[model samples]
Target: MPKPPGKPRPNSRPYTPQRLLSLAVHHEVRRKTQALSAFKDAEDQRPPPEPQLPADAQAQRHEPAAYARRLAMPHEQSWGGISPFAKDYARIVHSSAFRRLQGKTQLIPAGENEVFRTRLTHSLEVADIASRIASTLNHGSGAALGGYRINNDIVACASLLHDLGHPPFGHSGEEVLNERMRDYGGFEGNAQTLRIVTSLESRLGLIEDRAAAEFAIAQAEERPRGMNLTAGTLAAVLKYPYQLGATGRKAGRGAVAGKGIYEEEMPVLHALQALGLGLSPQRRTLECQIMDIADDIAYSAYDLEDTLEAGIVTPLDLVAPDDDLLEAIRSEEGVRACLGPLAGDMHRANTRIVDALTQVFASLFDLGDAYPQIQTDSVEGNRARHIFVARTYLESVMHARHPMVRRQFLEALIERHIAAITLVADADAPHFSRVSVEPGSRLRIECLKAFNYHRVINSRRLKMYHYRSRKILGELFDTLFDNAMERDPKIRGLLLPDRMHEQFRAQGRSQRREAARLVADHLSSLTDSEALRLHAQLTSGQSATFNTYWR
Candidate 1:
C-alpha cells in the first residue's frame, strides 16, 4: 500500500496544520479519572492491601477525558485523531516496558552510567525530538493542509516505548537471547517493545466495571492487551511490521532478521489493526514515518556521541585521509592487484554514507517557530537543495579533525575491524563476514551495516564482558535450578506458584526451560556490582554484611 496522506519530506519539508492535527490525536488520550474509575472499582471490590498500588501509576497518568479537555482547549494540530494519541500515551507511559528501559543499557551497562542515558532516557529524547519536529510541521497557519498536524502525544509515547522490549545486556544480550529464542521466533528489540506494551507487563485489578473494557487485558497470555492505545501509535512503533514467516527474505538476511513480533503477541498486533487505526499489514502511517525517522536520527547521532564520550573512538582517525596507506598498499603489486578498480568506489560510498547522516542531523532541528528563516533558492530543486546542503554541512563538521576525534572515530574503526574478522569461506553461515571493496551494491550495504555494528558495538572488550556475563548468568541459573528443583520447598513454592505448578508438572521440559529463563531474567536485571557480589557470595559463602542494619 502507498503511504498515508500528507507525507512530509524527510527532515526539511514545511510543517502543515494537518500534520499537527494528527500529532494531537494520534494516540487518543483518555482522562485517568474516567478510564481508571473502572480499574479503581475493580481494585476496591477486591481485598485491601494488594501487592500493587491502588491504581496503575502509568495508566492513571494518561486519562483520555483530561486529554480531550487539553485538546479541546489548546495545543498543536487540532485534528481528527487526538484520541489515538491519548491511547498511545497511556499504553506507553503506564506500561512496565517503559520502566524496564531504565535498567537497559544505552552505551555502557545501566549501572555504569546513571547520569548518561539508558534505553528509556534515549527513547524520551527521541520522543521529544519527534514531537517537536511534528509540531513544527503542524504549526503552519493557513488553508494549506490546515487539518494536518502530527499528534505529539503519540510521537512522544511511541518514541519513549520503542526500546521497551529490549532484553538486558544491550545489543550483546539481545544477540544471546535472540539466538536462544529463535524457535519461539527470533527476538528483536523493537518486537519486544511491542510485546511488552501489549502483554508482558503485569497489570493488577484497579479500574471500575464500566471502565474495565477500556483497559481490559487480552484473555490469551500470548496476545496484546488493549493498551487501548490508538492505532496510529501502534503503527508508528512498528519500524518493521512484517513477521518472519511472512517476510520472503532468508533467515539471516538483515531485512528479515528483525522482522516478526513474537507469535504469542500476534493476536494483540492484529487487534490493534482491527480495533484501532485501519492500517494495512506491513505498512506504516504517515505519523509512523515521522516517528521512525526520528528514531533513526536519534540512534545514529546519540549512540555515536556516547561511543565518543566513552573515549572509544576518535573523529580524527575517521576523517584523516588514508592517502599514504593507500599509496603503500597500491605500491605492493599483490595488494594492488587484489584491490583492483574497487578502492575508489569503496571510499566514495563510505564517504557518501557519512555525509548523508551528517546532513540529516544538521537540518533536523533547524525548523520551528523559534528558529530564524534560512531559506534557499535552489536551481537544483527544493528537496535536492536541502539534501546537498545538509550533506555538505554534516560532512564538514562531523568529520572535522579535532582533539577529541578519537572519541568519535573509534566506533567506526571497531566496526571495520569486526567486518574484516567475520568473513569466512561459508556463504550461508549463521555469522556475518566482512566484504572487500569489490562487493556488489546489496552486498556492500550489508557489509557496511555489519562493519558498523562490529566496530562500534561488538568490540573485543565488550564481547569479553558479554562472555563473562553470560557465564555468570549460567552459574546463577544452575544454582537456582539445582537448589530449587525438588529441594528447597520454599523456593520451589515461589517458582511453582499454585496456578503455575500443574502446568509446570505437565510440561516438565518446558518448565525447566522457563525456569532457567526466569533465573536468567533475574540475573540480567542485576547491576554489575550486584551481579559480581551475588556471584561471589554464591560461590564463596560470603554473607552480605549490610543485612545487620535491616535487623
Candidate 2:
C-alpha cells in the first residue's frame, strides 16, 4: 500500500476533523513545552519512579481496555465495548509507518524483485504465526491460565509492528544509524519503532466524544501521540525493556538496541510501567515473547525458502555442505548446544549436519509421497524419477509446484515449532504465565538460523551488497549532517526534505544531539530503493528526485 500523503500511517480511529485540526498545534506546542534532551547520561533522563512497576501490575493483564497510552485520551477509550488492543491492531494495519514497510528490506533490497520478502511481508507472516500462537495459547491454556485469555489482537498487532523501525539495507543500516546517533540516544530499529508509533506517526484520538483535544492540551502535548496503543500492546511491542542511550550502548547485534526504547521516550516508558506492564523477566509481555519467537521461526525457516526460490542455494548444496558452512555452523552457540561438542572436528559435524538436514527435509518435504510407485523402486531411482518429472514439466507444473512446495514447507516448519509451544506458568514472575517452545524446538531453530546465515546472508555476494549499502547510508548521513549544520538556510534547505526541514527548525542548536537524532530518524524512515535513489539525488548534481516518487 502507498503511504497516505503522510501518516504514521496508523489508520484513523475516529477523531473528528474539528479535533484533528484543533490538535494541529500539538507539534508546535510540544517543541515549546518539552526540551529535547541532550545526549546526556541516560540515568539523568530516566523516570524518578522505581525500576519496576508495582507488584500488582499483573493484576491488570486481563483487562485490555485498561491498557494505557502515552497520553490519556478517555474520549478514544469508549470504542463501544471494543477492546483498545483491537483498535491498536487496526491503527497499525492502516498505519503509514506499517505500509512504508513494503519498501524496506527484509534480507535483500526491497522492490528490486518480487520474490524476496520485504519487511511488510515478513511482518504480516510473523503476525500470522503470532496469531496462531495466541490462539493456541488461548485455547490450550483455557481458563486455567489465570482465568484470563491471552489477547490475540495484542499479540498480532505487536507482531505487525515489531519491525517498524528497521531501516533500509537491513542490519547494516541499523549499525550506521546507531553509530551516527550514538550520542543522540542511539538508533536501534526497535527503539525507532517505538518512536514511530509514539511520536513519529503523530496521531491523536479521533474526536467524537469527550474533551480529547483539551486533555492533550492539558498535558501540554502538541505532537502526535503515535498510535496511542494500549499499555498491553505497548508492552508487547517492547520486546526490549531497557534503554539504548549514550552510556548504555553495547557492541554487538543486541548492543545498540539495549532494551529497545530510547531516552526520548522516558515518559512513554513511565506511563507503561504505571499502567501495569508487569515487571518480570526483563519486562517482556507474554505477547512480546510470542512475537519474538515467531520472528525467530519465520526468519530461520522462510529465509531458506527464499534462498531456494531465488536459486541462490540449491537443496543439493545444503545436502553436501562446504567446509566454510560447517565452520560457520560450528561457531554458533545455539548450534553447538544442539549438535553437541563436535569441538574442532567440523568434518564429523558436517556429516551430522547433512544427516540432520536431510532427515528434516525428508520428514517435511517427502516429494515421493505424491508418487507412491516411485517409492517402491530403489531410493536413487525414486530421486531420479522426481527430478525427471520436474524437468519434464518445468514450465507447466514444476514452476507452479515449487511455490506450493515452498509454502507447504514453510507451514510444516511453523507447525513443527508452533505445536511445540506450551503455556507455562512463571510462578516467580509477575505475569500469570508465558508462552514457551520446547528446548528441542529452540535448538532446531538456532541450527536452521545458522544454516541460513552462513549459506545465504554470509555469502560474499551479500557482503558486497552490504558493503555498498553501508557506504550509501554513511554518505547520505554525512551529507545530511553537513546540510543540517549549514550556517545558511538556503543551502540547508536545498538537500533536506520539507518534513526533515521542519524537524530541524523545531530542534535548537543547543540540541545538537537532537539534530543528529533527527537526521538519523530521517534516514531510518526511508525504504531501500529510496535510500539508493536518495543517495544519488543528494550526492549528484545531475539526478533530480522528488518526494512524490518516494513519500
Candidate 3:
C-alpha cells in the first residue's frame, strides 16, 4: 500500500535562478546515471543481434509497400484489409494527444480569433500539403525522388503528428519546460513527441505485452507500448534521429541543438532499427524529407496569412520593400550570401506579386471611388481580404511566371537531389540517408521565418503575453516541484491528477526526481487557457468552479 499524501514542503530554500540552474544540472546527471544503469542491464541480458537483411536485399527496389512494415504489435498486425500505413493514419487521427493540439498554440494564441491557426489546424494543413507533395513526387517524375515511390500515407501521418509535442503557450512554454528539465535530460518538443507516441499515450496499451506473453511474464510487469505505429511512419516522424545527453550525436545542420530521444527511449529507437526495414540510424528517410519540406511551405504560407488577418502585418507590408527592414534582413551573412545572385530575380518577383496583390486588395475595398480604402477593420472584411490575398499569392507561384516561382521550382528540384535516399552498398547494419535543402530556398524560408520572428513574434504586443507566460510557467514549475516532494497527501493530490499522482508516489525513493519530471510533463500537456487558470489558482489562491485539469 502507498503512503497517504500530506502537507506542502517548507519553503526554506528560495528558488533562485542559480539554484534552479544547479538543480536542473543535477537532475540531468541523475537521469543519465539511471539510463546508463538500465543500458548496462539490458546489454548484460543479451547482446544486440546484427541486422538480418541480406547484402542483395539492400539493393532491392525502394517502393512504398516494402517500407510500410508494421511493428510486431498484435492489434497493429490484425488490421484486416486496411493498408499497414493507413493504420498509422487512423491511430494518429483518433489520438487524444492529436486532439489536444486544437487547444495548443500555433502562431498566435488559440481562440484569439477563430481564423487564426491552432496547432491542430496547422497539423491538418501540413498533412494535406505533405500528401500533395508525396502524390506529386509519386506520379510527377519518379526520377525526382531518386526512383523511390513516395508514400503519401506515411508522409501525411508524419506531418500531422510533427507538432504533437508543442506545449501550451507555444515555444515559450517549451523553453520553460526545457529549463526546468535541464538536469533531467532537458526537454524538447520533438523528443517529447517521440516519448508521447511510444510510452505516455495509453491508447494501445503495452507494445511489449505480446513479447511478455510469449515469455510467460506476469501482466503486472507490462509497460506501455505507445500507439504501436508502423516502422515506416515512425521513421518519417523522427526529424532528429539521435539520442539525448553526452552519448548522443552532436547536432548537425538542420537538426535542433541537443535535440533527440530521452535516454529511456533508446530501446524503442533500437527496436525500430532492428526491424530490418532499411531505415538508417543517422539520416532521415525520403518520406521524412518530404514531410519536412511540406512543413516549411505550410508554415511560410499560412502563418503569414494569420499575421495578415490579425492586422499585425499586411500584404502591402510584405510587398512594399522597407529599405531599413530589407537592409536588416540582407545584413545577415547567410541571407546576404544566398540572396546575392538571386537578388535581381527576387526583386522582380517581389515587385510583381506585391503589385498584383495590391490590385486585388484594392478591388476588395473598392466602394465605387477612384481610390481604394484599406477596409480591414471589420472581421468579415479582414477575412475576405485575406482570402483574396492568399488565393492570388498561391496562384502567382503556381503559374511559375514570376521569378520567385522559378526560383522556388529550382529550389525544390535541388531539395530532391539532396533528399535522395541511397542504400549502403556493404554495411552490415542499416545506415540512414542524409537529407539537404537548396541554399536559395533555405535562405528564403529563413527570411520568411524571420519576418514572423521579428514582425509579429517579437512585436511589442505579443512580447507582453510572452513575458507573462514565462512568469506563469516559472511559478507553476516552482510551486509544483516544491509540493511534489512533500509527503503530505493533500499537496500531492493538488500537484497532479490521481493517475499521475499515483504513479509519482509509486516511485518510492526516486519520487522527488520523478515528481519534478511528472510535473514538467503535466504542465507541458496543458492547453493555454488551462495553464493560465491553474497559474491563477496556484499563485493567487483563486477558486474557480470549472475543472482546469487536462489529461
Question: Which candidate wins on lDDT?
Answer: 2
What RMSD does each model have against the real structure?
Answer: 17.5, 8.9, 13.7
**lDDT per residue, candidate 1, 57-176, as tens digits?**
424432222222211101222233324366457646776556657876776667776665688888887787577555654553112333333457766877887777665667766666
Cα TM-score of candidate 1:
0.56
For 1-551, candidate 2 gives per-residue lDDT tens digits of 11111111135455565656645555346556774422122212222121123335545546443454434443353345455567787889888888889988788667668978999999999999988888887787765565566778878988999999988898789988887777667778888998888877855655532233334443424445777776777778776666665233331233332445788886787777676655333446677889999999999878878777766765555555777777787788767776676745767766766665554455433455555655557987788787756644443234323888768766787798999998777544424466667866776687678888788777876888889999999999988787788776555534566666765555534256766777887888888877888887767874674452334
Worst 10 residues of 3 by lDDT: 39-48
TM-score of 3: 0.68
Q: How well is each residue in 103-203 modelled by candidate 3, as lDDT tens digits?
A: 98898988788767999999998888677666655565455445665667788899988999888998788888888888877888888888888777754
Arranged by lDDT with the best first, the candidates are 2, 3, 1
How do the predictions measure up, each by TM-score?
0.56, 0.78, 0.68
| Residue 158, model 3, lDDT | 90
